[model samples]
Target: MTPITSFFRNLEAKCCAACGQMIHEQAESYATECAPCQEQASFDAYKYYHQKR
Candidate 1:
């Protein structure tokens, strides 16, 4: 797949846009942080719940 397609595919897999953490699909759209990462990334909160640990 193309690089762009591969990136979005990662989103479908609930991967963090910033840290590549695996998380819930529900947190895919408009998100980049999992629960743990979100907590620490309060400065730049990732909409997603699958943030890095």
Candidate 2:
């Protein structure tokens, strides 16, 4: 296997707060600022759906 593949294989997994999408450790750098969500880590589901207006 290639080093890049192996590196990705060892990465941890996480879910995006904004989109509920599976995010990998290697992608964290980019995922943290998801273009679709405007990079708002503060705009999670809880904040969007549960917070008082």
| Alpha-carbon RMSD to native, per candidate | 10.8, 7.0
Residue 22 lDDT (model 2): 68
Off by over 4 Å in 1: 1-11, 43-53
Once fitted onto the true fold, the runs of candidate 2 whose alpha carbons sit more than 4 angstroms away are: 15-29, 33-53
* Superposed Cα RMSD, model 1: 10.8
lDDT of 2 at 51: 70
Q: Candidate 1 on 15-51: residue-level lDDT in tens? A: 7666887878563366766777777776456544446
Q: Pick the candidate with the highest lDDT.
A: 1
Q: Candidates' lDDT values, in order?
A: 0.66, 0.62
Return the number of clashes found in candidate 1: 7
Worst ten in a row by lDDT for model 2:
33-42
Q: How well is each residue in 1-53 modelled by candidate 2, as lDDT tens digits?
A: 57987887777776666687766455537555345565454567658877767
